[model samples]
Each structure stands twice: as structure tokens, then as C-alpha cells.
Target: MSLFAAETRIVRDQAGRSVRVPANPRRVVALAPSVTEIVFALKQESRLVGATQFSDYPPEADRLPKVGSYIRLDLEKITALGPDLCIAVKDGNPVDVVSRLEMLNIPVYAVDPRSLDTVMAAILSIGDLLNAAEAASSMVADMKGRVSRIRQLASGAKERPGVFFQIGVSPIVSVGTPTFLHELIESAGGRNLAAGDTPYPRFSREQVLALAPEILIITSMARGELFQKVKEEWMGWRELPAVRNRRVHILDSDVLDRPGPRMADGLAQLFDIIHPDLAGKY
Candidate 1:
């Protein structure tokens, strides 16, 4: 056994359940896009046998056998593939699927990384489990450098705008402290108006009207009728400070919401939107 392997230790998951598996597991199947990206970052594509439907990042991830979305996982298909280990999100996927996989002794594990710190820890954990600790350490260091640089640049900004992240128009939902999106807002030096009480929640117009944010950020997956609807509706909120200031901007949902390597890029884009002042520094 290698020194890294001998030193490795297993930790309880977000649900506080104790389970034991290899510190460095081969034949891994990632059940979420984020985990898929993390595995690729560790340069362990050779060990990845399967992925979820949306694991399109790193390009080649699209070429792998997709087990379907976390919410609707195909247990029989996964069992047939016989991956040595499986990794799924704590809350993104259905609990029933995890339960079923457990009954079959598929060695499926769950993790929830809602905040930035948790995200880093999750990446390192995945890397360690994959025997890619060196990669994890390097990746974490690089990510931290980018985070530090952004904060340094942001700290010097004269004006930090208040941000209103619009997930839906009719319901008028926005981000909160519990969501990673909320951290993105803070990283960009803007105050998130919505509390997001938890990771992605619904909000009402009255709640939004009270905050009166200066910037409106809408994440759009497609640019068709849906985009038009989001644009026209928010543009109609004439009383909003963002609408009044003409700071309503649309961002790519996949790049921002995927929770992968592009997290730094997402933070940079948000920084650009919330504080155009920092753009010159980069």
C-alpha cells in the first residue's frame, strides 16, 4: 500500500451516517455532473465507468454510459454495469434510489456540499477516494488561489452592488444564504437579497420588493420563449432598482449551476456583473 492510501480515512456523510469503503476506489460511477467533473479533474477518467445524464463537461463525459438523472436513476442498468463504487449527491438524487442501491450492496455513497468550503472538502474527498489526492491537493490550492485573488480585487471596490438572482419570474424567486449561488453573490462583492432559507427555495414578489436590489442576474439554460419570458417580465418590473439602473443581465445556467471546475469562472462573471470595477484588475 502507498503512503497516501495508508493515511486515508473515511468520514461520515452530510446525513451523519458512518460507512466504510476504500480510501481510493477504482471502477467509479458518478451519479451527478459535479462529481463527474471532479473525477475528471483528478485525471482519473480511466477509472470512470459510468455517469449521470447531464455529465457533459470535459466533453468525453458525454461519451460514457449515462445512468439517467439522479431523480430517476435506473437501478437495474447501474447494477448491470457493475461499477466498483458509486457517488451521488446528498439531496440532488432521490433517496429511494440510494436505498435500493444500498439493498443491492452497490456501495453507493452520498455527499452534500452546499457552501464553498463544503464544495472544496467534497472535491478533496472525491480525489482522495479515487486515489488522486495529489490532484485534489493541487486543484484545491489552485481554486483557493483564484478565490483569494477575487476577494482581494473585490475588497478594493468602491461600490458593491446588491444582487437579485432571478430563478423564476412569475413567482419572483431569488437566492439565499444557504445556496452556493448566495456565496457567488458574496464572492462578487454583492449582497444577495433573497435568504434562500435553504439551498434553492421559492420567493414571492413582496419579499423581492422589500430588498430593492441594484443588479438582477437571471440564469438561463436556453434562449427561446423561456428566455423571452424571463427578460420581458423582469424588464417589466419598472420599480426595481436593477430595472431602473439597466443592470439586468442573463447568465449561463450550466456554467454557473453545475458546481464544477468552472466555479471560478462563474464567480468571475458574477464579479463582473456586480462590480464592473473589478474587471480592470483581471
Candidate 2:
């Protein structure tokens, strides 16, 4: 027998659950966009037999058969694909769905990349599962190098702006300390004005006005027209420092919202926004 002939191995997922998965998962299904992205990063996209509807990055992902959304998965379709393994994300995939898949004897590997460090770990773990350790290590090294450079640049900044990231306008939802966005904000030398234990917190207009953030960031999946509309609403808040100084910015939700390989790009964008003067320099 080969040195590592075991066809299946026991691995602990991010949720601290022991799962027996194929040592080399050739037929894989990604239950979340982030998970799909990681597989693509590992150069194992050909192994993906199925993926969620939101797994549209890398362009090639959109061509794959979609099992359904992360929350409302099509178990039948997923099973029909005859995948040897299914990769899910902690926050993206519903717990009940994972349980259902498990009951059906599908090997589910759950990953949670809530923070920057954990994000790197998730990539490494996925690589390990897919038997793409070298690719995963290379990807991680590149990511670390990029992040280290950003941190080195950010450390010398004299002042960190107070940034307010707006997720929703109607209910006024904002990112808190528990989410990756909050960590990205801090890492890019900006302070998240929304202070709460909740990953995403709702704040009243009065509360936001009180914080008086020096910078405003808006997240949107829509393009020019919708972005213009959202920007117009914030324009009315003339008293806000961001409004007065025109520091308000709009970012594509895909970059910041999805925790994946593109996170380095997201961090760079945040760094540029927080410290515009140090843009080309970095």
C-alpha cells in the first residue's frame, strides 16, 4: 500500500465536529459561495460537481450546476450529483440543512472564517481536505504577505478615521465587532463606529448621527442607479462629517461580504479609503 492509502480520514470541522471525509475529495459540492471560492483558489475547481446559487465568482463557477442557495439547499439535486464531499460555511449554510445532509450519509465539512486569522485557517483546512496542501499553503503565504504589507503601512498612520459601514438604510443595519468587516475596518486603520456584540446591529439615525463618523462606507450589490439612490439619501445628512467632507464611499458587497481569497483585495480597498494619501505609496 502507498504511504497514505487511507481513502477516508477523520477531520474536525470549524464547528468542532468530527467528520469522516474522503482523503482526496474528487467529487465535491460547495454549499456556500465562500467555500466555492476557496476550492477555486486551490485550483480544484474541476472537482466541484455542484455549488450554491451565489457561487458566481471566478466566472466559471456560474457554469456549474447549482444545488440551491446556502440557506435553502436542494438536497435532492445535491445527492443526484453524487458528490463525495460537501463543503459548507458556518454562517452561510443553515444548521438544519447540514444535519439533513449528514443524515443522508453525505460528508459535510463546515468552515467558519469570521476573522482574518480564521479565514486563513479555513483556506488551509479546505486545502487539506481536498489534498491541495501545497496550493493552499502558497495561497495563504500570498495572502499573508499582502496583509502584512497593509498592516506595515497602516501602522505609521497618524490618525485612524472613525468609519461607519452602512449595510441597510431603511432599518439602518451596520457591522459590529463580531463580523469580518469590522475586523477589516480596524485592520485598515479605521474605527468602526457601530459598537455592539451582535455581528450585525441595527441603529437609529439619531444614534448614527451622534457617533459622527469621519468616513461613511455603503455596501451594495447594485450598480450605478441603485448606488446613486443610496448615495442621495445620505447626502441629506449635511451635518455629518463624511457628508460635509465628501468622504462617503460605495463598495461592491461581493468584495467585503464574501470571506474568501479576494479578501486581500477587500482589505486593500478599505486601506485606500481609510487613508487615501497613502494609496499609491502602499
Candidate 3:
């Protein structure tokens, strides 16, 4: 396939916008961490000349030219990169930024992978756009296989423990039914106590106590004193089942927060934490 082929294909992005992209783009930029991860997963990172500051996965991505962040993109820097293609995420990358890129005649492919299935689809779509269909398909298949094995193992579990996933400590933020984290919790054979229509809901201490989650998984993005403090505060709820049973767990936010390839690892970790008996089975 010629990189400068006179061929173009129209595709619908995650934001439901139609875009015409090059048949084989030589220069690309990603505006979100998840998008950058997908590009690396497809082994097409060589074409990625620019990325957001938060695109720190794969380690090498950190060395790329910084294009500001998802919320605030450096238009001049991105323009100077002369990218034929730009990847964005519907949830993280703002619509105005994507619009600005499009106004500058840069093709933008936005993706929204809010669920496991959608995440796999987003990888495949990106692969198709980058002309790495085979690699993308293989990666998606591997991810699906891992998730299926976990599902099989979880199916045999006699009980599904009630789980409370803590994302923030101050306002007590948690994942709700509309988010991928909720799906991950269910896939790991745990019932999310914060399941609701809201994507990220703030819960009160009294509400959490009433819900009575058997397991408390804290995704402390920070480390050291802050992480210790969050756990210490939860420890004060001695009457809670998770605290009483010593099932409070502090997990890495990178794996849990980013909707990318590492999500499979996060799911596996959740399974292990929630059901220790099924450890090493999947």
C-alpha cells in the first residue's frame, strides 16, 4: 500500500462524525492516552509523531512530542507536526479540539470504548484506519479470549460479593452502571453497590454504609501518604464487612482508569482480588 495513495475512505468516528482519512497515513498524532495505547498495541507507534502529555503508556510514548492534553490541545504544535491523521477519544478529548483539528483539514478519528466489547471494536477500527487489520484483529482476539476465560471461572463462583470501587477519596467518587469499570466489576463476579444511571456518582459515607459492600477496591491514583490516608479512613469503618474481613484493596489507577490493552490485566487482578479460590485458574 502506497503511503501517498490517492485513495480515501469515509468512516464514522465514535462521536458519530464522518471523516475521510488517508489510505495509508505516514504521520499521526493521538490526543488521548487510550488512543496512544491502541496505536502502540497495533505496532504502528513509529507513525505517531505527537501525543498528549498523559500518553505515558508503553514507556516510549512518553518520549513523543507533547501536544498538550485532552482538554487543552496545543494547536500550533499539532499543526507543526503535519500529521495526516489524529486519534481522539470521545470521553477524554474535547469536541472543540477535534473540531479545530478538522477545521485545519486534519482527519480525526475519535473512539469511545465504554465497555469491553466496545474497547475491542475501537482497537479493530483503529487498526483498519492504520492499515494494520491483521495485528489489530489478533490483539482483540487475545483480549476477548482472556475475558472469556475469566467469565468462565467467575461463572462457577458460588457467591458474587458486593463491591465498592473507590475512585476518589475526598468527595467519594465511584463508577456507576454506565462506565466500563462497572462492567469489569461484574465480569470479575462482584456486584457493584454503586450501580446506577450516573457514570461517575459521588456517594456519602452513610449511603456506603447502608449499601454494605463486602469488598472495597480503592484505585488511588496517587501514592505514599495520600494512598495510606485513603486506606486509613476506610479502616475507621470497622463495622463494614470489607474492613472487618480485611478485604480492602488499593489498586493501581493506570490499569483500572485507562480503557486500553492493559484493561485485561486489570480485569484479571480484579478477579484475583474478588475470588482468591479461582486464582491461577484463568
Candidate 4:
């Protein structure tokens, strides 16, 4: 048997690729912020030796050895971490980087968590990888319970508001049907005006104004003054129903954007904003 044979086990990742990962990985690297969040959710943070840039949720992740950004990984930094296993996101992590890690005999388990449903699956998969199956199951159950409650509350709503979710400021970007933002909007009893084939579609101010969104939600990575400025800009468009009704709100990009435990929290927040009447009752 090879030197690693006894210490590792073969398992299929979400990408359908079989990986030989350490039975008890003492040194693991997270290739994406979402992956880092999942490891923390499973209480497996101790196993993580490295994490990509912007894995700042839970605060503790910010202290881990940085292996560069998810899109632009630092191979040398990752290698120096001596990670026995690396968890990667299918859509975020560069394929070449994952391939190179595998080539170097570092097992890479790629997880594809596109929506809320798949996020749960990724959590379960990662939990199994880290020998935290019980924790993963508990977390997933909590997420499901929260979602069920939201759906039930949303069903009581008298009307669904048209929501325009702005993620980008320059050139104006909005999410489409395949995105988590769209799912959150729809789940929270709001219609996503940007729903279409394009995952992240660029929108002109005129185009958005024509749609006449009832609720305009802008999620920003920036803080304080910048976000307030963006909100003020939208408020200037008096023709918009969102602006007239004062339904324009700023959302924290981290809570909703990342496919992790906090997604449920984001959904709850969306529900409250989309249906304030029902929110007070809850």
C-alpha cells in the first residue's frame, strides 16, 4: 500500500470527482469564502490551515493564513501551508488551481453550491469530509426549519412586491433567475424584476426606472457613507415606486451573497423587508 493509503479514504465530491482525502485532515485549506464559512459552521475551523481572501465572516477566519483570493489563488502560499486537503467552490475557485493542487497530491474536494438547496448539500458533504456529520445535519435542519417558517409567513402576504436587487454600483448589476438573490426575493414573497437567463445582468438606470420596482434593495460590500450615498442616489428617482414609498433598503452583501448558514438569516431579513406587515406579527 502507498504511504497515504491507510490515512486517507476515497469519497466523491459535489463535482462528481472522486478524491482521496485525509481521514482526519489536520491541515485543510478553503479555496473560497463560502467554503471557509461552511468549515466554521461544521465547527471544523481547527482543521483549516489556510483560507482564501475575503473569508472574513465569523471574524476568526480573517486570522487564518491567506492563500490569495478565490479567483486569483496564490499557489505558493497554499503549498507552504502544507494542507492535506482543500475545499473549493465549483463556480468561484479557478479550475486550474484545483487541478494543480491535485497534481501536487493535495486532495481537492470541489463543492457546487449555487442555491439554498445545494448549500445544504454542500454543508452535509463538507461535514462528512471533516468528520462533523452530526454538526452538519443539525445546521441543515435549522436552515430548513427557518426556511419553512419564512415560506409559511410569506404565504400570508396579501401581495408580492416587485424587487430590484442592485449588487453593483458602476454600470448597475442585478441578479437573474439562477442566482441566490433571485431565490431569496421570490422566497420572501417578492418578485425579482431581473429574473432572466443572464445570471448577472447589467442594467441601465432607464431600464430599471421603466420596470418600476416596488422595493429596491442594494447590497454593498462597502460600508457606512458609501452605502448611504447609493441609497440617496436611488431616492432621487422620484418616479420609482420604491423611492416614493421609501422601500429602498441596503443589505449586507456578506449575509446574502455567501452560500452558507447565514443564507437563512438573509432570507429572514428579506422576508421582513418584503412584507413588513407580516414581519411585525412574527
Question: In model 3, which residue pairs have backbone atoms overlapping below 3 Å?
Answer: none
lDDT of 1 by residue, 57-171 (tens): 8899999898988678888778878876788898778888888887886666677877667778888877767778888988888888888888888878887778878776565
lDDT ranking, best first? 4, 3, 2, 1
Estimate, for each residue in 35-104, the C-alpha lDDT of model 2 and write its tens digit: 8899998889989999998788889999999998988898899999988899998886888878888998
TM-score of candidate 1 against the unseen true structure: 0.86
- Candidate lDDT (C-alpha), each: 0.78, 0.89, 0.90, 0.91
In candidate 4, position 235 carries an lDDT of 95
Question: What lDDT tens digits, residue by residue, belong to model 4 across residues 176-278?
Answer: 9988789999999999999999999999999999999999999876667888899999999998999999999998999999999999999989999999888
| Ten residues in sequence with the least summed lDDT for candidate 2 | 1-10
| Model 2 stretches with alpha carbons more than 4 Å out | 1-6, 221-224
Clashes of each: 2, 0, 0, 0
Superposed model 4: Cα runs more than 4 Å off: 1-6, 280-282
Best candidate according to TM-score: 4
**Every candidate's CA RMSD:** 3.6, 2.4, 1.8, 1.9
Per-residue error at 184 for model 2, in Å?
0.4
Error of 2 at 126 (Å): 0.9
- The best-first sequence of candidates by TM-score reads 4, 3, 2, 1
| lDDT score at residue 194, model 4, on the 0-100 scale | 97
